[model samples]
Target: MKRWDAILTIDKLAAELIAENNYKGKIYATGSPAFDKFRDIDVAKERKRLRKKFGLSENVFVVFYAGAATPAGWQEDEITFKFLAEAMRKLQKKHPEAVFIAHQHPRDEKLGRYQKLAPDLKYFDISKFLPAGRQGKIDDTLLPMMDTVVGMYATNLIHACYLRISGVSILLPNAGGKRLFENLSLDDFPTKGRKNFSHLPKKPPPSRRPMRLKKN
Candidate 1:
């Protein structure tokens, strides 16, 4: 660890650890430049372009599900997907314009996790739109194009925060109630009184302040 002049991290836990350990190197928490890139985007403009390019109507309630997977096991990932699928189904039924877009984990594509978990989602229509994620350029622009972001524990929530989109951490039934973010659930989503997803206004609402950039 002493070989480097300094250390850089994006999370508070890491920065705390560095200080607690009394590392002699200079340490700085430079938030992900990748996520910061979309903070100041024109959300309404991006939404129009993406909808047109994807053949979606302006009124569609676009819900983006950013998938996550771990090498340890597929149990949690399966539960998360299943819950999201069902929740989206209900959301769509209540609002005919709703559309769920799946941003699958890049590795899940290779491992075919969805196929194995297929049996659990017998009645839910999980196939609406599937998009590639984590790709540098595409992901940076993708968050701005969505109406809302949903996921478990993933870095995409940070991007959602910067993009000023409402992000919800899905706490699936019977699974760990541990949350990555707060106050969003199947019961509360419908009552949030958010604007219609079909069309965006001339300007987007303000977002939380982004982490200031720092030199490493």
Candidate 2:
């Protein structure tokens, strides 16, 4: 497939894939320019400001669910939403300061479906805070404020990992789930163990080295 003169990739793994697939184009693993916003950010100060702006106390335990739109047969998004809602309900009973919030994928047409799916559980709609054009830029504005990010194998978890925020993936019971879990080290709780998420650290760890993707 010699279709182009050059290619730019987000990471080394992606560059390697292109080479492995026998693509003869010039490949550069320059990392994504989108991450530039994270470079000089004062995470602590920004997080505090956002928390105050959002009417959350400094000590609040913010659990953010990053929603994704899945294919028809793969109900991972719906399953994960219900699971997270129930889990958060139990978590809130124990920690009254814990706040659960969710942001749906900007492209997902079924907006506000989670409210109907889990009517008993209440969660903050963080998307409402986004400015008109910034709805798709949650990684820049909202992710740093989260104590923990939950999703069903969404790419936002990668951004969460970069921000030093704890990430969890509660995937569907299928081969795709197994493969995704193996690729990312985010905590994978079994069906029975999914009800409990008390092990998350109260505060995110200090900034460390960038994440290295696991090889299959």
Candidate 3:
């Protein structure tokens, strides 16, 4: 693309970003995906069906941790998994009926420490259940149904936030250590019914360039 659109405080960030890095393109901030909430994916019947296939009980409290296994820049093996798995293990004592269902990214389920914890701990490779095209929407469906959704560094959290859900806990485990973006904190969130950041430049009405962008 000629000029890529940015998101959040990206316009200002782009100034410093462009100064340090060599690049060329228009940069503008696009808004958040949180507010654009859609209906949760339909999987209730299917989950029950799968449960029957596995001989699992009907009262299972499905806890799903499905997202990028090795999402981009973050070190996957260390921080994100470490804290999450540990937290779940600790959280399990109270929720004995809980059945932790994780969809391993890149087909690697059944990893370290996870294999040892008997019946309650289980790994689910969702790729088998969801077709490639429909996988993302599945995350949207499964998250809200959980007893509590707690994860670090995953896009599905955006959907969870959109639902304005309570009781779900989020743990941002950054190993290298940097603040992460929250739905409320990001410039994309609304303020007093107005946009959190700058308003969109109104379209030019068949005349001159936008008044804000025009120098004259």
Q: TM-score winner among the candidates? A: 2
What is the TM-score of candidate 3? 0.44
Q: Arrange candidates by lDDT, highest first: which order?
A: 2, 1, 3
**Regions of candidate 3 where Cα sits further than 4 Å from its true position:** 1-59, 74-77, 105-120, 124-138, 164-216
Q: Candidate 2 residues 92-146, lDDT tens each?
A: 7888778877767656677676777877665776666768977633654667788
Residues 107-134, model 1: lDDT tens digits = 5543445445543332222333444452
Error of 3 at 87 (Å): 2.2
| N/CA/C clash count, model 1 | 2
lDDT (10s digit) by residue, model 3, range 119-194: 3454544445566775523545555455445455455555555544433334442432222322223322223423
Per-residue lDDT, model 1, residue 70, is 55
Clash pairs, candidate 3, are: 3-26, 41-141
Q: Report the Cα lDDT for candidate 2.
A: 0.69
Candidates by TM-score, descending order: 2, 1, 3
Can you give the TM-score per candidate against the true fold? 0.56, 0.64, 0.44
Report how far residue 156 has shifted in candidate 1, in Å.
1.3
lDDT, residue 171, model 2: 59
Q: What is the clash count for each candidate, in the order shown? A: 2, 0, 2
